[model samples]
Target chain A: MRGRRAFFGFLGKEVRHILRDWQTLLVLIGMPVAQVVLFGYAVRSDIRGINLAIVAPQPDAATASLASRFMDATDTYRVVASVADAASLEPQFRDGRVRQALMLPSGLAGALGRGEPVTIAVVTDGADPNTGSLMEASTLAIVRAWDAGRTGRRAGPRIDVETRMRFNPTLESVNLFVPGLIAYVLTIVSALMTAITIVREKEIGTMEMLLASPLRPYQIVLGKVAPYVALGFLDVVLVLVAARLIFGVPVRGSNALMLAESLLYILTALGMGIVISTSTSTQRVAMMAALAGTMLPTLLLSGFIFPVSAMPWPLQAASNVVPARWFVVITRGVMLKGAGLADLWRETLILAGFTAALFVVGIRRLAVRLA
Target chain B: MKAATREPAGVGSGAAHPATNVGAAVQARGLTKRFGSVLALDHVSFEVAPGELFGFIGPDGAGKTTLFRLLTSLYLPDEGESRVIGHDPATDMWALRRRLGYMPGRFSLYPDLTVIENLQFYASVFDTTVAAQMDTIEPIWRQLAPFAGRRAAALSGGMKQKLALCCALVHSPSILFLDEPTTGVDAVSRREFWDLLARLREGGMTMLVSTPYMDEASRCDRVALMQQGRILRIDRPSAVRAAFPRPLLAVTAAGEGAAVRIGLLAALREHPDAASVWPFGSTLHFTDRRAGPDPARLATELGEWLAARGIAATVRPISATIEDAFMWDMTSAEPAA
Candidate 1:
């Protein structure tokens, strides 16, 4: 009973420390909401408001009607310019006034009247390959739809291909990022925050007094990290709520499972933090180590922005060790895919393994006495 | 004190072996520690009697902090062993930690925490409450009560020290280890802090305090003069001063000026019979080569010697202080190096 009271006292002290630092508290609570809003609005994969130039050497009813079709096919394509010659569209593409250009052959109405085979070319700027390809595909889809509507019969022998995006059908990038955002925010809030807090005690010499007290090293470690766990959970909930209310992302799976997995991941990140604090004697070094050691790996190697399967073999193997990698999978699986324990037990096990291993290393590395 | 009766029974029993079963409140036999290439504490050994106020007096880097850390179990010795309140700091630190209170060399309390909050936090950590040990810390806490709501960082150096002391004493530990409790504090506050320690000592509380100020040594029941990780001497303040083995003289010129004092010191160092000369405050301390000499004869001779050198000065034989004894031991022990 006495030990439990001491642990709570230590835990209360840790909470008081965080509460008194208003700037840090602001960052702790506000950073997640701000990051979610920023990334949700800024990072987009869907094509919208794309400028298009129609090149027609001859103006005719067919060409004018086709230009109208491009303009009327949703707001995805906005006819920014209509040039009489294909040569005139060069400056439009060069200066980025136009992102895509649809070129119709000369005498296109006469050819269609003669029922002759003719091809139309779709030109696009490929500076950013991802958006460039998306624009081209969207332009093609519009042109195919227009052609099919114009012809009474189907176009000669074509292999029609249809693609369906599962989970996030509209392919909203925010849907993918929200899950990763939970992992990212928790990693920073748990690992980086805990590491710096622990190192601050060492820097200010309070760790010496704590070590000299009746509290065991494990008790100290647990007390120091307990507050962060709560804060991390709050961050996860905040990000989840913002994702749902603001970004329209859904947690299709069990809310309890998502929360449980997030708690587990927070523990893993905090374990990483404890290991970091044990090795560093100053706050500056611990901050740098946490950023470089945990944050960087979570951002780059966890398949948050980039797929781990597409990385090199060595990087793929390295990604397996980043706790955030497993967490991202678990969160995306549970939040988006509605996966339960049956589908996510492997990732869950790996995360638990990481937490266990990191905590054992952290506790063992923590010295009972000063070196 | 309310908690005085709660003192552990095994403290003075001396039941265990390992050279610490001498019934001392704190004991060490050849405790040593090293940090990289620096030998922080050599094979140092000492003991503090129960209810005694023991002080380790030394300048910076004299291993006073290192010794306190070892005694408090904040550090483990590389060689030998130590026992605090009859519990080996190495093997039995849990019991030792609960029974001992440590105020580290630095202000270890949460700077952002209010004074009362810091006190309450420490009290709870020890499985006690501030109200329970109010009698033990009442003297210091009464002074700190006015600033109870203030953050510790805003307190004056002296107030900070008092709050730190209050926090250490909140649990009413059997013994206390205070490392340089008054290093940066003002002179008046330093005196006040020592007076507080004296009151605590009167209550039969065993304490081990370290300080870099030599004048503070006189207030300790017994002081260990430490230097370069070694204890030069350990005894009562008066006895340590009396142990100065050389005849010493205090020389000062009639005119009070920096130039006159500097000139007097230079000339005294050049004297053939002068063993060592150091500037002490407004006067210069002069030691002769001969061991035991009559004070009047030596003073007259030194006065005449300075007069013959065309520099008139007043020379008087003065008894050694703890500082003088410390300087003597430090200088005498340096020749071998």
Candidate 2:
């Protein structure tokens, strides 16, 4: 098409605008880097040094060894108090001295030696469900290991189930957070940046000039979003670099595939931006709409912070429509799980389908407005 | 005048009284456009010959910008048809776009880009470069050469308008649509801008320029005098002025004091024969309610009437300008059937 040359010319113009405008530069480079560093370190979900109180009323060597082994299980928990009686366990939890408490009954070792059933009570603060559940799981794992070791020396009832954490063996939240962070940064930056830039053109009245020119609506949209795709990919690299080098998050899968999928997601975001810009005529309204439209959906609905499966049925269905949800799945699958396209073709296809759908809708809306 | 005042054709009426000659650059028949409930351009029809400097003269909200936008193919009309360079703007907008250059009423060039960048960008959009059309825009671009590195937003109003015009012409289109090229410009700069247009006319470029200033009407080869989205008259500037049906009197208060001016204005408005008395600079242009064959007797009567109010004034008959004709047309309720 003869419009190809004009497309590049307009693309160059949009690139120059992005390069010259400090606000756009700030949004493009500064915000993503800052949010990644913040989310990686300060705002991360890794919980450490959860205080635990142990109460062993019998005061036997087996109960004390069990308590000591639980404390040494992982850095996630610490034995803050060793209560002499069960009466003081409740006080330690109430006074905020301990977030979790482990109670070994008086006959725990006797019951094991005599082949009688024994019950260990693990109490945790339910104020924060995430931390509480994590503490409870840690206590169970330690207790299970101790019982299994004792059962090997003698005959006892045990179910041997080996649990393997496939992707992040250490279960480090950094690995999980990094992928979500990339989704968030790319969505907000690319979508918001493209939206505000187009709205600015409309506000300044240059859009009418473009419409009056020989440049078609598709070329105009492409010229606008082509630069943003590059910017978004650059942000993807910056986030991945910071996540890998700074936070020690890994990229175990194909980096090329990860980047290609990221580019597809970025296109989806840019398409959303064009749609928003077409609906709005001013930069302020566009900015507000972008933030409201992309930020909340990416953060809450994309499984970036909360798990989609654990969400309500309606919310889970809604998340399927969020572009970032599929991207996040692809990012986690490729980067954390070392998966290939064969493993992630479904998510990739969904993202591609979304990009195409949004681009079509955006172009049609733009044509309507221009008409 | 008969050709100029031909009634706009009704909706979907094909080629009624085609004013489009072989040399016509643009033609519109019953081109009515509405924005929601607001009637922007109503049953408006006109044509411009190739290489002619045509002007649409009206005050603000007179639909001058709307007509320019419609002809530029930026908006589709609700009814009727418009052809630019022998192509319908409604259907053949893309083909027409390559042949037309439009400078919108607002300063719309990239504000962050340098003047040269803006020029180069627009030229490239037309699949050419600015260097290819240097001779065409040289007279204007040379004036803007020193400020090539300056951002468009930093340029003064006149310089900004010049840069806009230069960008619009960078592609060397067959027709140029300038919507109020000198609305807010200083008097000196406005004159210079029109002088530039006159030079463009010499090189045989078809231009359709709109302006709110009545004085600039004389600069055009012909003008469509518009008000409230309706064309009242279209003719040469002198003819439009001569079309003013009533005689005009320039009433000058014979004192330098502001109080004398105010008192004279108040006394004249109170006069029974004063049809309309509007301030024109320090003096006043007064139109009598009654048309009379005897101008000398009317002037004498106006002088005695001012003296009767103890305000010294002089009344003299003067030729009506476009402004007088516009005011007369605006105040009239209906166009002559």
Candidate 3:
């Protein structure tokens, strides 16, 4: 009973510390909404309103119909100029007026009637490889459909391949980022914040007094991290609600399961934080370690923004050690695919293993007395 | 005090060795500690009887804080052993921690917490309530009550010390270890703090307090004069003063300005018979090399010697203070730099 009282007392002190620092509290509560909106609106993969230059040396019936087809294919393209040659589009491309240009050879409509092969080029500004490749692919698809329609032959020998995006139809990047945001926000809130709080005590000399007390090191750690667990959970909820209400991201799986998984990941992150605090003696070192050691890995190696399978084999092998990687997988599976435990048990088990390993390491390293 | 009734269990199981010393509040057999290449404490050994107000007097880097940490179980000794209240600090820290209160050298309370909240937090962590231990901390708490709602960081240095002391005492531990409780505090507050310690000692509490102020040594029942990780002397303040080995003189020139004082110190250092000369406050304390000289004869001789140098000075034989004894011991213990 006395031990419980002491633990509660320590917990209350930690909560008061969090509440009193209005700046940290603001960051804790406001960062999630800001990051979600920022990712959803600004960091989009879909393209819109791409300025296109149609350069046809001679305006023939075939060229005009092709230009009209490019314009009418989708809202993604806006024809800024229909010049006679590609040379006139250079100034437009340099001046930010055009991002992609379609060049057509001088031809009569008779060339197509005689079934002569024509060479067409889709020119794109490759300054940004992602947007450039996307524009090139979109232009090629439009030309293929236009050519197939012009041929008016549905009985041609062709091997048609169909592609469908699973879990996130229409390929909304917001659907992908929202689930990943939970992991990112929890890493910051749980690991970084907990490490800072613990190191602050060590910096200010309060850890000496706490160590001199009857409370064990484990008790002190649990009490210090208990408030962060609640705060991390609240952040997870805030991110989820914001994702649902603002981004329209769905929680296809059980909300209870998502929360349970989130709690486990928070504990794992907190364990990582405690381990960091044990190894570091100052708040600056702990903050740097948490950022470089946990946050960077969570963002870069966890498949949050980049797919893990696309990475080099070494990085793919190394990503297995990042706890957030498993968490991101579990969250994406639950939120998008509505995967049950049977489908996600592998990731969940890996996450639990990380939690166990990190916590055991953390507690064992937490010195009961100052060295 | 309530702690008296709750004598720590397993006291008999400790390696007390009652034959040598029974009921010693604190006992250490060559406690030593090192940090990297620096030896913070070197074979420091001492004993404090129960209800004794023991003080460790030293200047900065004297290992006072390190010794306190070792005794409080905040650190383990690199060599040797120590027992507090019949419990070994290294092996039996759990029960030892419950019965002792430690106020570290730095202000360890939460700076953002209100005064009362800090107090209550400490009280609860020890599994007690503030109201239950009110009687023990009432004297200090009464002064702190007016600022109960104020943040600890906003308190003056003296008030911060008082609040730290109140927090350390809130649990009514059987023994209290205070490390440099008065280093940065004002003179008036330092006196009040010592007086509070004196009152606690009268209530039969065992207190081990360390300070850099030599004047505060006179207030302790016994003081250990420490320097460079070693105890130079441990005795009653008066005994330490009485143990001064030289005939000391306080020399002051008539109408002496800072320039004249400097000249007088330089002149005295040149004197063949002058063993040691150091500026103490406004006057200079001088010790002679020869032994067994009549103080009056020495004073007259020194006065004549100064007169011959075209300086009017008063030379009076003065008794040694703890500071004087400390300077003597410190200078004699080390080789000339």
Candidate 3 lDDT tens digits, A1-371: 88998998899899899999989899999999999999999887666888999988889988888899878846688998899978877888897899999888777355676666677788998888767765766676667666778854333213231231344534567888888889999999999998899889999999999888898888999999999999999999999999899988999999999999999999999999999999999999999999999999999999998778668999999999999999999999999999889999999999999999999999999989987
**Model 2: DockQ score:** 0.64
Give the candidates in order of TM-score, highest first. Answer: 2, 3, 1
- Model 1 score (lDDT): 0.86
Error of 3 at B175 (Å): 1.0
Q: Over the stretch B1-337, how does candidate 1's per-residue lDDT look in tens digits?
A: 1122111112232112122456778778788999989999988877777888888898899999988888887788899887788899888888888888899998899999999999999998899989999999999998999999999999999999999999999999899989999989999999999999999999999999999898999998888888888877777788778867889999988887899888888899999988899888888999898987797799999999999989988899999999998888888766533
lDDT of 3 by residue, B74-155 (tens): 8889998988999999999999999989999998999999999999999988999999999999988999999999999999
lDDT, candidate 3, equals 0.86
TM-score of chain B of each: 0.93, 0.92, 0.92
- The superposed Cα distance between candidate 1 and the true structure at residue A121, in angstroms, equals 9.3
Give Cα-based local distance difference scores for all models: 0.86, 0.82, 0.86
User: What is each candidate's fraction of native interface contacts (fnat)?
Assistant: 0.83, 0.76, 0.80
Off by over 4 Å in 1: A43-45, A52-71, A79-124, A133-165, B1-21
Q: lDDT of model 3 at residue B121?
A: 92
Candidate 2 stretches with Cα past 4 Å from truth are A57-62, A84-87, A105-120, A140-166, A368-371, B1-21, B334-337
Instruction: Tell me the alpha-carbon RMSD of every candidate.
Output: 6.4, 3.6, 6.2
